[model samples]
Target: MANSSTNSTPGSSAREDAIRFYQIAAQRQPTPAETAAYKFIDPLAGFANCELKIFEKNSDLGGTWFENRYPGCACDIPIHNYQFTWAPYPHFPSFYTGAQDIYKYLKEVAEQHNLRKYIRLSHKIIGAKWIEERQKWQVQIVQTDGRELVVSDGETKDGEQGEPFIEECDIFINSSGAYNNWRWPTIPNREAYRGNMMHSASWPDVDYVTGRTVTLIGNGSSGIQILPAILDQADKIYVMLRSKTWVTPALANRFAGENGANKIYTDDEKENWSKDPEGYYAYRKEIENELNARFRLYLKDSQAQQMGKEATKKQMTARLSAKPELVNDLIPDFPVGCRRPTPGSGFLEALCSPKVEIIWGEIDTFNETGLKTASGKQVDSDTIICATGFNMGFVPRFSIVGLNGCDLREVWTQELPTAYLSVTVDKMPNYFVMMGPQSPLGHGSITGSIEMLTKYIRKLVSKLQTEAYASLVPREAATKAWLAHALKWMEKTVWVENCASSFKNGSSGRTVVSLHPGSRLHFFDLLEQPRYEDYEWTSLSSDPLSMFAWLADGFTAAESSAAADLSYYLVDAPHLKQRSRCAEEPTRATATGN
Candidate 1:
C-alpha cells in the first residue's frame, strides 16, 4: 500500500488543475475485499517467496521510460488509472506523470515489492533451451560485464572468463517490452552521412540544438514532443515526414483553485477519496465512461460511411493551413489511424514558427553532407535524428528450442504469434510470456496489464508446484482454437482497418500485435485465471518411483535388452521411442556428438 501523503493536496504555488484532473482520472481508492479476492490468493504469496529472475537490457524499465526521454515526454493515461490495483502507490503526485515520475514510480514499486533482487540488470538473454532429461529450462544470459549467468546456480555472479554457464528454472517470463530495440529503415547510404545522427531510443546526452540546422525524421509521438522543444534552440528546424501522421490536440491544464490543490491534496481530501465508497465508485465509473465514449466516437466516426478519407483530408488541410508553407508537405495520403495518432500540446503552434519547415517526401539516399529526396531535391543538415520506431514485429530475437527440439520461433513464424490465453505457448512448456503478441492493451496503461499478468503467472506456478507436475505445456489443439478466435475478433476492431501503424504487420499488411476489439475490463476478466482444460499436465504419477528413478538416471528400457523385450514397459512409454532401439540410439548419439 502507498503512503497517505500521495493522495494529499498540492501546495498553493503548484498546479492545482493538473493535480485535480489526475486525482479524478486515477480513481485512487481501493476496491472492496470481495472485488480484490485474487490479491489475497496464497498462490501469489508462494510465488513471491520463490526466487524470481527478470532479464533487462537497459537501465530503464520499459519502452515508455526508456526511449522517449524528450523534454515533454508524459503519459496520456491519468496517473491513478495507470497504477496496479493490487500494489497501490499513495505517493504518486499527478494524473499524467512525466517520464521522470514514471521512472520513479517503477523504482518505488520495485523497492516496495523487493523486486530489485530478482532483476538481472544490464543482462541480455541470448537463448533458452529446454532440457527434456531434467524437465527444466536452461537459460543463457550475457551480462554487461561480459559474464554468462546460468540458472543451475542459486545466484549469478562474476565467474571465470570463458567458462560455460547455464541457469535451470521451472518457468520463464519475458517482459522485454515493445520498444528500445531501434530499427532503422533500409535507405541507401544511410550510414555514410557525415553528420551527427541519433535514434530516438538512444538520444545523445550532449546538447543537439545549439542554433544549428536540424532534421528530425519520423513524425510519431517522440517527433511531436521533440519538434516543439527544439524550435526554441535551433536556428532552422526541418521536420521530415516519410509518412503522414495523425495529429490529435492534447488538453493542457493549469492549477488556479483554492487550497494547495497545486502542491498536494490535503489529508482530508485524500481520506475522502480513499474511504468514501459511494463517491469513489461514482467518480471511477464516470472516468471509465468518458474514456470509453471517446474511444467509441473515434472508432465510429472513423468508418467509411461516417468520416472517410475526404473528411480526414479536409481536417488535415485546415490544420496545415494554419502554417501555409507546411500544407504542401505535412498532410498525409493515408487514413488518420493508419499509423499511431500523435497527441501534441504545441505541435501545430511549433510548425507556425517561421524557422520551422515541414518536408513531405521520400528519402532517396543520404550523401556525405545531406539527404537526397525522391524529387531530386537536396536538404542540407548538420544533424539528423532517426525517430523511426522499433522492430516489434520481429520478437523473441533469440531461438527457443522446447521439448522434442521444437523451435518456438519457427512455430510462430509459420503463423502469427498466438498463445493459450496469450500467456502459455503451444509446444513450449512452462514458458510464460508477460505481454506476448496480440496481448498489448493499447487503449489502457500497460502497468495494469503487467499486474494482471503477474496474478496469472502466480496462479500457474502454484498449480505446477502443488500438482508435483514434472512439466505443463499448452495443448496444441487448444492454442490453435484460441488463435482462430483471436484473429476473428481482431478483424472487427479498428486497429486492423484504421492504420499502417507498427502495431500491425508491415510485410503482410495486417494488425497482429495489439489486442482485438474489446474493453480493457473484458480482457482483464478473461485473463484473471488459467483455463485448466487448455493445458496438458505431465506428472510423476504417470510413472512409478522406480520407473521415474530410471528415467532420471538417463536410463531407458532399450539400454537393458531384457527390459526392452517386455511389452509392459512399452505400454507405459510416453512416446514411440521405447519400441525402436535404433531410433532411441540417435538421441544419445546426438547428445554425445557421436
Candidate 2:
C-alpha cells in the first residue's frame, strides 16, 4: 500500500490533485501471475488492462458512518449474509452486527482485496464530461483544500497550470451509498426555532441530551435507535412522529446481551435449521434460503395478507398499547410500511420512563425557546434532533454534463432518477453508477447488491479491453424498455401503491430512487450476467473523429470563459452571498414561512 503522507502539489489544479491521488491509489503493481488470473472476454480481446478506478464521494462515506453514529446503529442484515460471496467475511459472527462491526468489516474488505490502494480519500468528484474524441471521460475532482483538478490520461493536473496531469480511465464506478444526502421535511416553523436542532446525518459529538429536555423529529430507524439512548440522558424526551413507521420485532433488537440472538448457527441448531447437509454448508444454505424466502415474501406483499394492508397501523398501536402511553405517541396516522419498517427495540421501555413523552401534533412554528404545535400545545425543549432523513429526490451532487451539455439533475427533476438497471445512463458512456437509481434492496443485505454491481463493472471492464472498444453506453431503446419492465414490476410491490414513503413520491413530488418491487433474488438474477446486447458499443478506431467531435463540442473555450465569468459575478455579488449561506445552513424555523 502507498503511504498516506503524500499531499497534492501546491498550485495544482483540482484535477491535478485528483490525478496525484489516483496515481498513488493505482500504484498497486500487479504481478504477471496475478494478471493471468483475469479472464479475457470477447470485446477486450487484446487490449492492455491494468487498473480500475472507483471515484467515490468521501462526503457520502462520512454521512453514512459519521451521521448515523446512534448507539444501536447496527446493520439489520446478518453478518455472514451481508458480504460478497467471493469475498466472504473471515470471522463471520452470529446475528446482525453493530455499526462499528460493519465499518470494521468494510475496512477489512478494502485491505484484504488490496482495494485500499484504489481509494482516493477526502476527494470529491465535482464534474464528469464524456470526451467523444478520446473515447474517455474527463472527470473533474476537488481536493479537501479546495483545489480544482481534472483527471484523464491516468494523471492528475493542477488547474492553475492548465497542463495534463492524469489520463482518464476506460470505466468509472460510483459507490456513493443511499442516505448520504439528507432530505429535510417541509413543515411549518422549520427554521424559526431557537433551540439547538440537528439532522440524524448531522448528530453532534457532545452528550447534550443529558439532563436536558430533548425532542427528536422523525420516527424512522434512526429515530427508534435514538429514543432509547437519549431517554437515559435527557430529563424529558419526546419522540415526534411526522408520519407512521412500520415496526417488526427482530431477534437482535428484542434480545440484548453479549450473546444477543444466536444468528450464527450452532451444531445442533444448524442441523435443525437446515435438516439437509451436515455441518457448515448446511448452516450457510439454511440462512441464505431463509433470507431469500423473506425477500420473496416482501416482494409479494405477504405481510399485507397476514396483517391486512391498512391494518398495520392498528396492529402496531395494539402491540404497543400493552405498555400504554407509548402507543399514543408512537402510533402513526399513515399506513404501515408507508415508510420503511424499523425494528422496534427498547423504545417501549423508554416510553414507559416517566421522563419521556410523545407528541403527535404537527409543529405550527418555532418560538424564541421551543416548538408550538398546530394543536395549540407548547413543548419546551433545550435540544432538538431532526432525524428527518435525506432528500432522496435529489440526484448526487456530482455534476454530470452529458449530450448537448445537458445536466443530469435537470433530466431527472420530475421523475425518479432512472438508469439502465440502476447502472448505466443513456447519454453517459463508459460511466457506471454504483448504488444508483432503483438499485436499493428492500429485503436481504445491501452488500449483495454492491457485490453484484461491482462484479458487473468488472465484467464490463474486461469486455472493453477484449473488444478494444473505446467506450460503451446503454442504448436509449434498451434503457427505456428496461425501465418499463422495472416500473411494471414495481407497480405490483407494496411500496409503489400503498406506502407514503419518502422513498416514494412523498417529498419530491416524485419517486426517483427505489428498486423494482421484487425479490432480491430476482434483482440478483438480472445482474448475475452482463447483458451486452442492451448496450451500444463504439470503437475508437471506427469513430475516431466522432470521439474528438464529442470532446470538442462538450465545453468550448468560450463556454469555459462564460462559466468563469458567471462564477465571478455570483461570488462577488453581496446579496447572492447571503442567500448562499442561508441555503447551505439548515435553519431551526418552521418548515414553511407561515
Candidate 3:
C-alpha cells in the first residue's frame, strides 16, 4: 500500500457535514466486495457526518450465501482468498467453507462493525431517477417487512400489496451483486410441467432429490456442486449440459480427501496458530501468494495456461475412466481458465456412478412427466432443478432514468455498459456502482478489487463533501477513452475467448463485461488515486470565489483548541528523518573506524 497523510479538522461552530448517502445492499453473505463498501461508508458516517442507509431487499445480509443453501454448496475459492484482507477468519470448518459458515462470518462482521443499525432489511429500491434540477437522485423503494401475505401454495395471496415509496439521496451506491437475479432455463412448458421445479438460487430446505428422479439443467457452479452431493441420495440423477465446462482439480474437496482436496489442519497446527496470531497471518499470506502466482494462467497461450489445461484434462479423464462414453463429452476443448474452472474432485467420480446420467444435448421441450432432448430421447424426472445460472443482464432489473430521462438500459443497449474504471459513469452524476461493468474480478482474489474500489470511492466522496460540489460525473471523453483502453487490453485476454461464461455481457453473451482485462494488482495500482481533471464537476455557488465556501474559514474542527497538535504538519515526514539519518550514518562510521 502507498503512504497517505491525514490532518485533523479544526473545530468549527458550523454544522457537521451531512451528506445523505444510500447503499443498495446485497442480501447474501457479504462478499469481499460488499465488505469493502461497508468499510468505506462506515467511516464516512462517523467522522464525515454522512447519513448512511443500507437497503436490503431480503431479510439479511450475505447476498448469495443467505439465498443459495443447496446441498454441498461451498465456495470455489480458498476461504482465505475469498475474504477481506483486513478481516481474517482463521478458524473455519474447512478450506472450502460452506454457505452457512460464510453467512455466519458475514453476520458476525456486520454486528462487530456496528453496521446492522444502518441496515433496513426487507426493503428494496425498485427504481431510481436522476433529478437534474435538484442534483440528487429520487429513489423509489418497496418495503415488504410485514406486508407480504403468502398462501398455502406459496403464492402471494390477495391481500394488501407492498406499496412503492420514494426517497432522495445525494449519493447512491449500487452494491447489489452482478449475479443477484436468478433465471430459469428458456424451456417451453416450464409452467405446465409442475413437478417440484426449483432454481439453485431458491433451493428449499426439503430434500426433494432423495429417492426421486432429479434432472439438473446447466453445468455451472451450482450444477457442479449439486452433482456429487445428491449422487448417493437421489435414486437417479440426470445432469443436462448445453456446453462443456473445464472442471479442474486444482482445489481440494473438504470431504473427499482426494484430487488436491484441502488438507485438514491438525491439532498441532491449530495450537501453533492459536499461540501466535502473526504466524496464522503468515500462513494465510502463503496461501494468498500461491493464489496470486496463478495469474499467468489467464494469459492466453502462456506456459502456465497450457500446464493447467493439461493437468485438468488428465485429472478429469482419470476420474471418468470408468465411464469411457462420458469422458469426451465432459472434458472441454477450450483452455482450463477460458471460463471459470469448477473443481472436479467428486464431480467426475459421481458421473461414473450408475445412478447418474450425463445428457449432452439441447432440450427440445418439457412435458408433464419430464423433459425431451432434441435427439428424440425422453428423460423421466420427477423433480427438475434449474441450476441454469442467474440472469446476468449487467443492468438493474428496476428502471434507472438518467439525464434527459434516458433509461440506463437504453444507453447500455446503444453500446455495451461502459464506465470510467468500472465505477463512475458519463451521464450518471453523484452515482457510483460496485462491481460495475468491466469490474476487475476475472483473476485473483475479488476482495483486492473491492478494497481498491472502496478506497477510490472514499476519496471521491471526500472531494464531493469538502469541495461543496453539487455533483460529479466523469467526462464523456474520459469514460469512452477508458472503455476503448479496456477493449484493447481485453483483446489479449482469455475472457474474450469464445466460451459461455458470466463474464460476458448481457443476453448477447459475446461482449465481456463483468471482468477486467488486467490483473487485480494492476487494477489496485491504477485506482490508487483519482485524476480529478478527468471528471466534470458542478459547484453549489455561481461565484468563482465562493465555490469553496464549504471549506469554512480555512480551519478544521480539530484546530479550535490551542493545546492541539500544532506541529502535525510534519506527521507524514518519515522520509525526511530517514534522509537525515542516512546523511550522518557514513560520517559516524568513518570516525569510528579511524
Candidate 4:
C-alpha cells in the first residue's frame, strides 16, 4: 500500500467530467483481490508466525490500475470472477472493472485490513545478493517520499535522495509484475523529435494536445484504449501499426444502465448487496465457472478456439463495417488466443471516426516532426504516444546476485528465465517470485493468480519455520525437469502452434516464455504443496545425535504451556470421548491380570 491520493488530470472539460464520474462510480465497492489479500494475510501471519511487509514503488496500492489511468482503461474479464475467491462484491457497477474503481477497492482493502502500517511506500529495492554463510538476502534499497522514481536516471534514487541502505531477510519474494517495466521502441532519433512524447504507462496531462494532432504508436491494449478516449477531442489522430492485432469486445457488461458503458449503482442494488452476501457469493461463483470454461480455447485445435476465432472476427468485422477499409487492416493474421486478446469496447468505432486515420506499416524512424513508415509514408504529428508494450523481462530488473556471483540478469540474458513451478528459482535460494516466468494470465484473472501464488508462498514460509531449515534451494535438475515438462505441454497449446504474437518470445518468435503450459487449475494444484524431496535443504542444527532437536525440552509446546490445548489438532471431541470411554472399560484379560 502506498499513498492514496489520486492524480486529477485537468484539461478538457469533457475529459475532466469523465474522470470525476469514474471516481464516483468506482468508489462504491472493494475489488476482489484487495479483499482477498487482506483476508489471506491476517490468517497467514497468525498461522505461520511471520511478519509481512509490503514494499511499493508507486504512491498507491493498485499496481497497473494506479498508473494506467488512460481513457477507456478497464479489465476485460468479468468483474465478479476477477478477484479473490473469498472476497466477492455484489455491488459492482459493471461486469468489468475500470482502473479508478480498482484503485478505490484496493484502498478499501488496505484500510480494512490495517495493512498500511506494514507497507513501506516509496521504498524501491535496487539490488539483492544472497549470503551463503548467513542464509539470507542482503537487500539494498532506497526510499523516497512517494514521488515517482525515474528509471532512466542510471542512479537508484532521484533528486535529493537519501543514503542507500541494506535490509536483510530470510526470504525475498518478487511481486513486482511484468507491466512495471515499460518497453520503448528502438526508432531512430526517438528522443530528438521536437514534439510532445509520452508512453501510456506514464500518461501525463494531455491539456496541451486538446485540439492538436497526435500520432499514437502500437496496437496493444494501451493503443486500443487511448484511441477511443481521445477520438472526439483531438483534431486529428494517426494510429501506426506494424502488424494487425486481434480486437474483441468485453465478455460482459460492466455498467448498470442500458448503454452499459458508464453506469452507476442504484441505492437499492447497493443495499441489497450489503444485506445478501451469500446470494452475491453464489452469483460470483457462477461467473467464475463461466470464466474457467473458456480455458479450453487455449488448446491447439480445440473447438472452443475455432469458435472463438470465428466469433472474434465476426464481431470485429461488424464493428469496423462502417469503414470497411479498416476491417482487413485490423484483423490479425494469427489466431485469436495467440497473443493477449484485446477487448476494446469503442475502439473499432473510434477508428471509423473522421478524425482518426489508421496507418498500417512498420515505423522505420522518427524524424524531428514525426515518424516515417517502412513504405516511405511520412506522417506528421504534433504529439506521439508510445504504446509499444513492455520489456517482458520476467527476470528481476534490478541486480540480484546469487551463489558464486550468479547475477540474475546475466543468467536470463544467456538462456530463457526459468523457475521451479514459477515460484522458486534453482540457485536463488529463499527467493520466490509471483508472476514469474511461465505464469500466464491467458487462462483467468490475474487477481486469482496472485492469490494462488500467495498461497504457495505461505506454504513455503510454513515449511521453512516448521522444519527449522537454514536454506532450501531447488535442485538444479528439478528446475530443468520442470521447464522440460512445461515445454511438452506448450507443444500442444495454441500459444506455440499458432502464428506468433507477444505470447511467444517475440511477434515472430517460436518460444512461448510467458504462458503456463497447463491450466490455472493445474497450476493451483501443482503449487499447493511443494516437493520437498526435489530441494537440497540445509538444517539449522549441526549435531548428528540431536535428530529431534526441534522437540525442545522433551515436551510439546501444548504440554509445556498450561494455556495450550494438547488435543487442538484432534477433530470431533464427541468421537474422541466415545473412544476414551471404550478404552476406560475393563477387558477380561486385564481383569484376570494377564
Candidate 4 segments whose C-alpha is farther than 4 A from its true place: 1-46, 149-160, 252-267, 497-500, 561-594
**Reference-based TM-score, model 3:** 0.88
lDDT per residue for candidate 3 within 1-594, as digits (tens), equals 111111213332254433423333332225643564466556643324466667776667777777788887888887766776766777676667789988898888787777677677767666788998888888877776543211111122232147878878877777777655777788898877868888888787787988999998878888888888888889999989788888877552322344666555567766777788898888777777777677888878989888888887787788779987777887777667777777744787887899987787899999888889999999888899888877665666667787888788678767778878988887888777877887875675577677777778778876766666778999999988888888888777677787878776323244676777587777778888799999989876666766545655455645666787867767476588887887877877687996
Per-candidate TM-score against the hidden true structure? 0.72, 0.72, 0.88, 0.86
**lDDT of the candidates, in the order given:** 0.58, 0.56, 0.72, 0.69
In candidate 4 the C-alpha lDDT for residue 439 amounts to 86
lDDT string for model 1 (293-408, tens) is 44432243445414544554564556566676665566655445455555554676688888987776788999888798898988899988777777665346667889889887
Candidate 3 global CA lDDT score: 0.72
Cα shift from native, residue 320, model 4 (Å): 1.6
Worst-scoring 10-residue span by lDDT in model 1:
19-28
Pick the TM-score winner. Answer: 3
- What's the candidate order when arranged by decreasing lDDT? 3, 4, 1, 2
Which 10-residue window of candidate 2 scores lowest in summed lDDT?
A: 24-33
lDDT of 2: 0.56
How do the residues 1-594 of candidate 2 rate in per-residue lDDT, one tens digit apiece? 011111222232221110111110111111110121121111233323355444433422222543457666766655656655544443544465666666566556556655544445445455666667766666675544323212211122333232213437555554445555565556666677787877666556777788888888777777777787677777888777555556654422322223223255356553454454344454455667766664433433466434533444554555566566566555554433446666555665566677867777677776667787789888788988877766555365556666667677668875557889888887887777665677764655665666566557657765554334556889989888877777777655555544456676354232325665466777778887888998888754454433322222223233434454534434556688788878997675644554
Better of 1 and 2 by TM-score: 1
Candidate 2 shows a clash count of 59
Candidate 2 residues lying further than 4 Å off, grouped into runs, are 1-48, 55-63, 90-94, 145-167, 187-192, 251-284, 299-304, 307-322, 325-336, 505-513, 543-594
TM-score for candidate 1, residues paired by index:
0.72
